[model samples]
Target: MTDCGCDKAKAELVEYLHNELARDDASDIREHMAGCADCSSEFHVNVVMTETVQRACRETAPEELRVQVLARLRDLQASHG
Candidate 1:
């Protein structure tokens, strides 16, 4: 991620790009991205990653891989509990 001028603003921009911000706060972040080059580039990278994940999700994931992951998660949860 490009280091924007302010840490807080950069964090807000990340949340905004990920659609994790509240409606009222997101508008301000959107405006900041429009005016900031660093923020704009960071947002563009996030957009690309999001699109890549969405496209990848269309392909089938291995069932055995999913089962192994779930089994590990259950084991971890049980150990923690």
Candidate 2:
């Protein structure tokens, strides 16, 4: 199999994906990815997924769901009282 820079990037892949790599290492990874199609594709997927999850987490629960939860809590408190 042809080397696709995967071996070189593997050690720091997780860190790179998570934006935890140091400045120099991250720059090096970017440079390496520019020349490596496979690595670039994988990086793009990782970044997209990470951003998607982060965006999802930032969303508030539906108002109906929040109301339901609060109603359940009130019921439990009333029963105990």
Candidate 3:
């Protein structure tokens, strides 16, 4: 496997992190990261950021906030419709 240089690897890091790249492209990024410390470090940061965003998305709003938002939406619907 050829080392896809840092430019391509960095450019595709997000797609690689989210499994959005085609198989061969992903493999190329992985191979590049294996040998390039800079790309690897950037990939690690992206991984942590992706995990953090995923975790944040999983969190539910407070019950009071949910109710308030729903109430506001209902009021707007009633006013508009």
* 1-81 per-residue lDDT for model 1 (tens digits): 332344555777657767888776777666667788777788788889988988998998699999999999999999999
Q: Over the stretch 3-71, how does candidate 3's per-residue lDDT look in tens digits?
A: 889999999999998899999999999999999999999999999998999999999999999999999
Candidate 2: clashing pairs of residues: none
lDDT of 3: 0.94
Q: Report residue 50 deviation for candidate 3 (angstroms).
A: 0.8
TM-scores for every predicted model = 0.58, 0.63, 0.75
Q: How many steric overlaps are in each model, in order? A: 0, 0, 0
Top-scoring candidate (TM-score): 3
Q: What is the C-alpha lDDT of each candidate?
A: 0.75, 0.81, 0.94
lDDT for model 1 comes to 0.75
For model 3, what is the error of residue 20's alpha carbon versus the real structure, in angstroms, after optimal superposition?
1.8
- Candidate 1 structure, TM-score to reference: 0.58
Q: Best candidate per lDDT, number?
A: 3
